[model samples]
Target: MTLQEIFALSPIMLAFGVHAQLSKTTQNSTSNVKEEDVEVIRIVESRIQRLSSGATGLGLDSYETPQSVSIVEDDTIANYQLDDINSLFEHVTGINIDRTETDRTYFNSRGFDITSMHVDGSGVPFGDIFVGDMDTAIYERVEFIRGSNGLITGLGNPSGTVNYVRKRPENDFAARVDLTYGRWAKMRAVADVSTPLTESGTWAARAVVVHQDKESWLNLYGNNRNVVYGVVDGQISDTVTVTVGYSFHDNNAEGNTWGAVPQIYSDGTQADFPASTTTAMNWTYWDTLNRNAFAEVSWFINDDLNFTSKLNHINYEEQSELFYTYWNTGLDRQTGLGLLGYPGKFSAKDDTLIWDNTLQGNFNTWGREHTFIVGVSLADAQTSDLDSAAMSGFDVMPAFAGWTGNEVSRPEWAAPTEAGFADIKLNRYYTAMQLSVSDRLDLVLGGSFIDYDNEGEAWGASTSTTEDGTSPYLGFTWEAIDNVNFYASYSDIYQPQYYLNEDIEPLGSAYGRSYEAGVKSRFENNFLISLALFRTEQENLYEFLGYDDGDGVDDEDYSDDFTYALYQGITVASNGFEVEVSGPLNDEWSLIGGLTVLNMRGENGSEARTHIPRRTFKLLADYAPQWNEKLNAGVSVRWQSEVYSETTGFGRITQDSYGLVGGYASYTFNQQLSLHVNVDNILDETYLGSVRSEQTFAGSPTDYSVTLRWDF
Candidate 1:
């Protein structure tokens, strides 16, 4: 079906039971519509399991929260083979994944970059340039909140927040193993086991191990990854519990590109490169390692009160030998002689520590029962980097035409230098209350106070800053009907800037506010539907003014290193809407999908972030046949509107609208064994992987994989 038709018919089908098959699930068996039957259907409770805390830290389900939220469950992840963060987010509503290079990726939502991230309600330090490819084997599910989350995150942009929920040990004994083989000589193995460690079943432990080695469809590209995780859960008393865990991940990649292919030729014509094209040499490699340790304690003060505390520590290291190729004079269509090569060796290390504590309880107020939550969090992080450049000679490649990856000899590197260093600290105090004003109306009020400090040297300059601010949050939900709710919310955004002015002083922070309103409805059999409209306004965002001259400013003495580009603040606004639906249609079929529309403009009313698509749609559907009893199948579709980017001297480069299709199927021979198959890019659609900059990469082509599973 077309995008327009799908959007038009979704609400009608959901509200009035227009579809013949859906009617059976939406209404009772009786043909006649009675008032009592309508009321019975409206009050039907949800049977779906709920998370401890998701969008608001209130332990509320999607229909109860006053914001836009989406979830990717474990079943969906396994069926689609979403092994990595990039593949997992592609299925989320209103999320766009930009693969700028082989090993680097960026995400965008609501016309802004998504920078806020958490693991089990605790914030983590993350950036596109620093974090490596994240594996999802250790996670049970991923929760998404599609708007400003400053109330809980302390300080951040108005984009969105992502939280990953880890898999924990269960009281019962269970074990599973999987072996997979796929195209391009890919091989993978995974083992997971969980069991009760004590006779009383009050203590449990779980362990998981994974290993994968895969060759890319791109020439001269491959990688190997390994992961290990272990966790222990113990109940010290009837009202107290404790948990501890540790995880390690290592990945090594060869022939990874630093950037992507050039977009334009010397003649101002667009360049066309095959999906299998690569600009990396055989000797170049990128390797990364990560370790995490965490501990948690939960105490139930009484039936009406509870408290929880958590601590986490993380260490990360990276080493790489990379070669970057760019066209200084633009590429010539006939000769391809303008390529310039920059080879470098680099290493970096980072350490982070985080602590969070929360208290939640119920109280009787105004003849009604209300809920409140208060929390505090602390985060400390430090990082250092070393960089080495190639010798003065050997800066230009011989030719690009008919060139092989082994053509260039490894260049000699100079002495390593301290390229960057940073130390950051943050402390946050926050509280929120859910007031049960009446039987149908509920109000939520909360805010956060943050103290932040940073000291670092980067981008050939020195930096030091200290700032503090308060961000407030307000919202309300009205149960207009038994199973339907209307809600609205307001949130503040505060983000500090690291850029410096001509005077070598750090620029201040950017401030903003976000407003959102939506309607949510729950149906029988755990189906849910939501529609939201949102707007955000931000000011004091840094805007590059030009580089300063060598002369001193106002006749004052200044060093050469301080002559960097100056910047000023600017304002921008973003407005958007989203429609999402999820849950099972009946016993045989289930589906999840969404549609997003956005518009972003600068103060002058011109388009901002034009490279991001304004409209996108994603959907996934699964089916299980009753006759077969052991057969299952699924399909997925993703479509995006046209997007374009403007280069300094090359004008505009555009990527037209495109769509991709994928499918999967599985069969069980018995309770202990099963076979599964998956296919990506089923129609072999060719498109650009990323178009947010002048350098662009081609998307993946058709691929397939098969797996065998055993359960005990």
Candidate 2:
């Protein structure tokens, strides 16, 4: 049914702001409502509600939107003891993680790469190999939306988008602390405190601090980190609200690997490395530092009308010193010889600023209630990098068979020389309207106009590129039953290309279109189920061709170094289906599960995209017995199909399918204290975690941890 009619069925839960508070006492003090019953309702609502800012400009339920959305809230994160954003994505639905390196990772959806990210609804830029080193303690929840989000994020792939919602100051005083210990000497501590600054509880502040230190499965590789965050929230007046926050993170680590272990051996057979094996040297190091400051302001004109704006500034830097090896030179299958090494030091920095403004409200047209939203956003990002040689006496290690992790010494690097710099700016304006067509149907129409510009230095020369276009979106939703809704949507996206061809001509821009249809249903107001089918077509996709240089170097032009002239485009089509079920099925049990299947091909009907799986499944469940209120247990399973990639010397390497099983148990000592134990990879399965163009990374073995949480 229409949005207005659906809310009318449950005003106590769907109403907003001052209007909803008036009847809070009446609902809580009802004659039939008991304390335990109220607690169950609160738990269910906190875990299953569809209130989010990512699905639409205004908070909309899953049945009201035409896209796929999944959220990982604070309760789930704490229960699972997820340390960071990277760990959370591993359990999300319809998404695949490609951990090419220990610290760097990439996400793929529907055979396409996801490059769009937002913090508190403001856009953030992304790079190829940069790690988004964020601590999860400062976030309220992480939201993932599938399919094209061009209506809000401007130019990007038609894959998906991610948004991080920060924790806000509460009106009451609260404090919490957690201590955790795990294998590999891993130890972590976190503290969170929120308190009101005014007697009326209109002004408040919150602070979160975390410290973590851990040793890795790989030899000589470990991590040490420190994070601090603080936020202030104020109800300046009855109509105004404001929030400001700042966060800082620093990470130090040793034995950072530049690439994966060698996959090809001397006898032409694929080499298998032990889980604890590593090519990283004891003296190698990589460190990162990130700082962010943000502010948000909102004005509530009425229950149905509101205006919001946000500003964010981010600064990030990374420094590294290392020595790496490659088999680009043909390997000697008989002697395990013929490898080349390079020793270098590098540093990079990125600075960004983002601004966003939005206005949303409800209005009546032709005696029907409708919702409308208008927004404008701008982002500017600048990056610079430099590289230099290592210490004078430290030359590239020449002997691969006689080297060990203990033979390396710390490097004293020389001053770096300026390599390049870039400046990118993006501007976008968009509007959307949700119209109630009939008692059983709703229509959504929106479009975004984008202007993009880039200026940088390439190959020792100054360069600039500019492009602009409009992305259009349309969707329709029909109520098929009391709680089941069917929806269909179509969206288009455009992005500019900055590469030059062999003839020194700039290539054409990239374009893509997505079509999706889905059905969603909610049972008992506590459980949710959805199934979706989607098809996407992309053109002008770029790839670099290996242009053999006379020196036997595969893709390099040794003379002028590898240039963009070798990159060209090809057409691709991808189709996929996804299914998900999540939330509580009853008062004593909860569950979450998902499955995905994909088919992607090129112009010649050949399988496209290497190092990515074609199918994936995940499940997590928890149960608390009614006979015992102090004990709870959980279990999880994850599986992925086979994947393969071609090598220059070995021809082709395939990784067989594998599955991992884990479980958790918790004992509640009282209302304010609890202890939990968790285990992962219980079977200790040995499998390839990720495959790169020339190498493969191995997965971790069995591990366990214990956590104690105190809330006051």
Candidate 3:
């Protein structure tokens, strides 16, 4: 069918499906129905399932997984008013969000960076500058598996893996709309609708739309975002199902700062600046666009075996013009007049395709029941030539007097030039087996073989390389008692490097090992508690040496020419402990909380990883009065220990320990309408939100939002 015809027939299709379903329930009427229609009706009446797909790739319960797993469901998203995927990380245990750049965000897990991402168990390329801008409204839930996950991710950091499960079409008709208004002229609107598309109820469709426009606390900074997502699902037969989806997103921002305010002034004294201080120029801006499409097919051969396949395609583009102010020479403590600003333009386009196929089954071996899975994946990624340019002799800004938040005209420059291009392809084959040695004990074994080829050009130099290796994985679980379980797992993973080393050659990939052990407890399946200890070690780690050249000539610095170099052969280690509790405390009260203690250092026993905190805690609870079914209230608190920046000859800058408190309340006036009010940073604490070698970003202050939602 044509696109226009499909759009016009959607409502009619939904209404017909609902009417057909209702006709079957008439008591006095004898109407003959098709066999397939009967089956579809029965399936549509079943309750929703909340199993974790990313935990083990076996569709097992969270408690049954051998590793530490956390799930943030749809209810949690609405209760906390988490608008985007990045906001959800703040509440997860042992995970930290680092805003290193205006358009990029890094998720730090247990002192390691989370570089692997998946959608519905299908691996995809990472490192997108606009990944953090993804809206969570279209996702059913997010699943996180902590510790080594090489068995499935193939090539990635050992820290963890994140899976975003998109919402599927509903068997019955449902629709919802939300409108929100908040501080700093923030406005947001979201709409979601789902319904059956065929009379037999075998086909279903869902669509979601979102729009947001907001201004930040930083001087003259603002952003506008728009998103659209749609999906179609069909049960072709009793044992076959198919799904297809597409998503589009665009974000544009003006007056974005390339870096935060300077941390220290000349003379070695820390600089004190207002929270509204900004490093952005009036003409500086950043924009990004992303498009994605995916399809999946599942065949249930029998109760004992199943097969599935998934394919995905993605296209992303980003363009920006930024200005950076650097203190080339030591600033005079008294004058603060030693800073110089430079401007540059950058644009990049990326396209990727991924395909994954798998087969799993249950069988009996040696009189023991076991589960086995085999899978293969392929990925191809390509980037267009990067277009870039720089303007010399641009006027510099003086920081001694502070910023005035006034508009500044940009300087005219020369034409842009093509810098480089790159292409990467990866192939992986993996398998895993779960053996039930006895009723109370189980063992899991898995491994993957990866082959990679990369070709690129940099600084007019052509480069091509190929690498292949094997990653092994193992895990086991033992039921210590009826409601308690003990688990342990280990894996070997690697990370590919793209930068040239001190020898002016591309660095070899780094290798790492992860080990973890934990205890999990369940009380009546409604409450859960878990405690885990983990340690990780890596060799030949890559580290960025900054723009300064050892010689005193500023012109040779990497920052001036946009060239990057890396230092290798550095060893690093991290060990940490975590405790988490979630679910209902009772019929009236429900709570979710966690605590983490971490210690990370270099081989020489120095705290080289400064962005991660040594201690962190989070707590959120909700209460509903037995006498009032229409009202509910909740409160949350978060705390983090001191964190420092990378150490330099000038010393280190630290963000002191701090805490924030927030609360929310909701009232349901009727079955179809509700109102909610949320207040964040209720205590109005002032602290540093993020830090870099040269800049620091302040946390947000007290803010309030009101939302009205309607369902039909």
Q: Candidate 3 on 1-712: residue-level lDDT in tens?
A: 4222432454322211110111113211212545445446433431143233455566556677788788888888887888887777887877787765555677878887787778777664344233326778888888888887777777646678888888888878999999999999989999999998987667889999999998888776788899999988776566566677889988888888776577766555666677777777788888888888877766656546667777677888888877776665655577767666667777878888777777877899889879877888888888865545554535555644466544345756567666667788788888888899999898888888888788986555454568998778888889989878899888886767665665546677878898889988989636889999988898777666654232445582335444544355678898988998888888898878789898888989988687678899988888898899999999888899988774454456778888989888999999999999999899899876676455756677888899999999
Off by over 4 Å in 2: 1-51, 391-403, 406-412, 459-463, 497-508, 544-567
Off by over 4 Å in 3: 1-47, 125-132, 405-408, 461-463, 548-561
Per-model TM against the reference? 0.89, 0.89, 0.91
- Candidates 2 and 3 compared: the better one by lDDT is 3
User: Which ten residues in a row are the worst by lDDT in model 3?
Assistant: 15-24
Clashing pairs in 1: none
Ranked candidates, highest lDDT first: 1, 3, 2
TM-score of model 3 vs. true structure:
0.91
Clash pairs for candidate 3: 266-331, 266-333
Give the C-alpha miss distance for residue 464 in model 3, angstroms: 3.8
- In angstroms, the error of model 3 at 426 is 1.4
**lDDT of model 1, residue 530:** 94
Alpha-carbon lDDT of model 1? 0.77
Per-model tally of clashing residue pairs: 0, 1, 2
Q: What would the C-alpha RMSD of candidate 2 be, to one decimal place?
A: 7.5
